[model samples]
Target: MGSPNEMVYIVDDDSTVCDALSSLLRANGKNVRLFSSGAEFLSFERGDVGACLILDLRMPGMDGLEVQKLVSNQASIPVIFVTGQGNVPSTVRAMKGGAVDFLTKPIDEAVLLAAVEHALEKDRIARCEALQQADLLARYHLLTPREREVLPLLVSGLLNKQAAWELGITEYTVQIHRGNIMRKMKADSFARLVKLAGKLKS
Candidate 1:
């Protein structure tokens, strides 16, 4: 189930289509916004929430694929395309562009709801992972200069003596830095520290 704050953006030139989508999504406890054009949808600044886009493939000005390309670079809301013409090329392009699903009209209420659920869930997972990476980065920034210097070498399989030799420091000093790194990074074990190191490097 989605929160009441979770939004569904319906972008279509057809007023009737947008009205129908907004009604369906609102009835299922989702916040809905209707846009008459791709440009109008792009202009709206979305809040930080697990949201998805319902886009019409054909439009007078900027088409669905065009909007998708621009949105991918910015908003990154998951998309479910509803088109009267569900052609092969368009479907392949939308999928490759990271659309959640491509639906054909007359849209089945059940199928659209299922796609919306999947898209929202996917967005939530992505946002959660992003938050974790940000938290890890914050911890990494808390290390002192010497501790930072020692971290990579230790995680790279160097013993304290080896790391000390490489950095022209005493082995005891290296051991101290290692302890500090573990404490600052909140790593329960050396293995966990190594895993954190990998994420930072990547």
Candidate 2:
């Protein structure tokens, strides 16, 4: 069974295929959303929810690859492509676009289920990273201008006296700022503070 909050979105033009996939996923304690075309799926607002998309490679209006490109820049929902007439070129393009998996028509239920689980796990990890980054940024914004000035020098392996001289402040003032930065960033050690700075810089 997949996570209750995690959804599996299915976008295929064939009604029978969509229905069968939806039922199978739902029966296995997974949430499912079925779309008849890529456009319909794109129109839905999926903001920060952990989910994976099962997209058909060929469809009218907009194809799966087109949708994948668009979403890759947005929320980056993990994609698993399902195609009735998949070709080498198409599969290569999908893989390059960060697709989780590609399955041909008449896909085995076991294979499809495994792919969906993998995609959902990818989404979960991405969501966690996003949340952690947001938290780090929020903490960083709480820093004072002087603290911000001290941070780079501290992380760059500068001694307190050197950082104070660079910032035209007393060594005692630099130590005070360092303590504040550590407390505000919730970093327990000098190494952890350096790591947090790296994440912020990246």
Highest lDDT among the candidates is held by which one? 2
How close is every model to the real structure, measured as TM-score?
Answer: 0.96, 0.97
Residue pairs in candidate 1 whose N, alpha carbon or C atoms collide under 3 angstroms: none
lDDT score of residue 164 within candidate 2 = 92
lDDT of each: 0.93, 0.93
Measured with C-alpha atoms, the lDDT of residue 48 in candidate 2 is 51
- 38-74, model 1: which lDDT tens digit per residue? 9999999888777999999999999999999999999
- Candidate 1 stretches with Cα past 4 Å from truth are none
lDDT of 2 by residue, 1-202 (tens): 7776889999999999999999989988899989998888888887556799999999998999999998887768899999999999999999999999999989999999999988999988898999999999999999998899999999999999999999898999999999999999999999999999999988
Residue pairs in collision within model 2: none
Worst 10-residue lDDT window for candidate 2 reads 41-50
